[model samples]
Target: MAKSEVIDVRVSRRVLWVGAEAYPLHNIARATTIRIEPDRMAAVGRFLKSLLILAILTVAAVAVIGRVDWPSGSGQDALRGVVVFAVVMVAVFAAQLLKVLMTRTYYALVIETSGTPRAVLVSTDAREVGGLVLGIMDAISNPHAEFRTQIINYNSTHIGDKINQIGGIGNVGKRVGS
Candidate 1:
C-alpha cells in the first residue's frame, strides 16, 4: 500500500472536518474505536488441505513405484523426481503459512451517522485511533472542542459494519468455527 497523507481534522461550530469531507457534528450519532485482527483460519485451512493432498500423492507414488517393474535404471530416477517435487511443494506451503502469519492488525475510528457507520480513519497504531475516538466524542458534546491528528489509511474494512454484516464477531467469517 502507498503511504497515507496527513489528514486535517477539526471539529468546531458543530462541524467535523475530516480531510476535505465535512460532516455536521449533529449528524454523527456515535463514534468509537474497534480493533480489527485479520482472520487467518481460512488461509491456514487451505495450506493444510494442500499439505494433505501432497502427502497422499507422495505415498501413492512410492507405492506404485515399489510395485511396478521399470527399465534397469529408471525406477530410481522416477523416485528422485518424486522427492524433488515433494520438496518444492513443501516449500510453497511454508511460504503461504508465513504470509498468513504476517498479516497485521488494524485499529479504526468508526463514526455512526444517521445512516450506516463508516470508518473515517484507520491506523495500525491503536493509540492514535483511540485518541481520535475520544476527541470525536468530546467534540460531539462540546461544540467549541477541536482536534487535529495524522492518520495512516491502512487497508481496512469498516469494522462496525462488518460486525453487523457477519452477524457479530465470533459467529461466522471472523473465526475458525462458527
Candidate 2:
C-alpha cells in the first residue's frame, strides 16, 4: 500500500499554505470545516425502487405470457429471458449497495477566497482538520500567531460541484411562469 502524503500547512498573519497551494490571508474571505457524509439511505432507497420496478416488470411479463397463448417453446424462451434480465439487474444493485456500504465519512477544510471556495485539505481525521481551522482563526485574529502541521492520507470528498448545486433543485432558483 502506498503511504499517504504528509501535507504541509502553514498559517501566519499573511498567508495560509495547504500543501503547495497558498492563499493570502487577506484574500481568504472565510475558512471553515465541512463534514461529507455518504447518503447511504438514499442509495438503499434507490436500490429498493429499482427492485420494485424489476418486480413490477417481471409480474407484467409473466401476466402477458400467461394471457397470450403462443407455442410452448416460445413461452419458455421468453420466461428464460426474463429470468436472465432479472439476475443481471440484481447483480448491478448488489454492486451499488456494496459501494455505498464501504464509503467512509470525511472532513474537509473549506476555504473561500476571491475566486471560488475550495476544499484545500480533506482527511478522515476530524481532530486534525479541526485543529487546522482553529489555527487559521487564531492567525487571523493575532498577527504573530503561526503554526505548522502535517496531514497524511489526503482523501478527496468530491464536494466542489455539490456546494455549487445546493438549493438548485425544484423551484428554488427558478422563476415561476417565466
Candidate 3:
C-alpha cells in the first residue's frame, strides 16, 4: 500500500503505464503524412452525389429499355446504353476505392497505463507527422504504505504533477533549497 510500491513506466511513444499496478495508460498517434486538401469531405460528398445520380439514371435507363420494342427495332441503341451504364458503375466503384485508400493512410497511436489489479489511465492523441511527444518520470514511494487508498492518492497527485510538467503547463516536483 505504500507509495514506493507503485511506479509509472513509459514503454514507447505510444504506451504508458504504472508499474506494479493493474491499470495502464494508453496513447495513440495518428499518421500525418497524408494531407487532407481543402474541403476534404467535399470529395466524399461529391462521390455520394454522383452515386445517387447514377442510381436514378440507371433506374430510368432500365425503365426505358424495358418499355422499348425489341423485336421491331432500337435494340442496338438500348444495348449500347446499357454498356455505357456499366462503365459508369465501374467508375463509381473506383472512386469509392480511392477514397478508402486515402482515408487509411492516416495512422493512430494508443497509450495505456495499468498495474496489478486494473488500469489507471488511458489517453489517445491524434496528430500529423509532427505529433505530440510525452515523457514519463520514475515513481516515488509513499510513506503511508499500509493503506491502498493513500498510496493511490499520493501516486495520482504525483502523476498529475508529472503530466503538467510534460505538457509544459506548470512546474512540478520542485524542492525548496532551504
Candidate 4:
C-alpha cells in the first residue's frame, strides 16, 4: 500500500504533508485543531519498573527468611542474602529508572469535516506538532499558500445575532425595538 494513502503526514528533518489523492488539499472541508497528549506507551517503562521493584522486594523478603538454615551452619546466612538482594535491586532500579523517565508526548492532528473530525495524525515529536497543525490549517484554508510564518491568527471574529440579546429569546426584539 502507498505510504501517503494510509498516513496523512510524515516527518523527519522536515514534515511532508499529504492527503488522499482523490480529495487532495481542497477536499479538506472544515477547520482542524491539534491536541497534545501523553503517549499511551509513555508510562510503559513505569509499569516495568513497578513490576521489577515488586519482584525484587518479594525475592529479598524470601531470601531474608530462607537464609536461616536450621541444621547446617555452612549455609548462606541472612546477612549475605540481604546484601546480595540489596545490590541487585539497586542496580536494576537505576537501569529500569532510566526507561521510566517520561520523555515522549503524543501530538494528535484532528482533521474535521462538516464540524466532525474524521482523520487524526499522531506524532511523537511535539516540537514540530504546532507547525504541522498550522501547515494543515493553512493548507485547508488556502491550498496553494506557502508556509511563510508560524504566526497563527487566533482572532477569527465569528459574530452571531445572539451577541445583542439582553437576556433570553423573550428580550430578543424588545431590546432592539426599544
Best by TM-score: 1
Model 2 agreement with the true structure over 49-141: per-residue lDDT tens digits: 999999999989988987888885898888889889999999999899889878878888999888888888788889988988888877887
TM-score of each: 0.78, 0.74, 0.31, 0.42
What is candidate 4's lDDT per residue for 44-97, written digit by digit as tens?
666566667767886777665676655564344655665686677666765655
Put down candidate 1 lDDT per residue, 1-178, tens digits, no spaces.
Answer: 2346567777767788877778898898898889877568888888899999999999999899988999998999999999999999999998988887797877877889999888787778898878877888888878788877666676433335343453455644446344
User: Cα RMSD (Å) per model?
Assistant: 7.1, 5.7, 17.8, 15.0
Q: Between 1 and 3, whose lDDT is larger?
A: 1
lDDT per residue (tens digit) for residues 1-178 in model 3: 1122323433332233334432222222221122223344666676777777777877788788887779755777786888797687868766775765464222222222232222232222123112322222211122221212111121232443322244455655566574
- As for lDDT, the candidate ahead, 2 or 4, is 2
lDDT of 1 at 154: 69
Model 3: lDDT equals: 0.41
The clash count of every prediction, one per candidate, is 0, 0, 36, 0
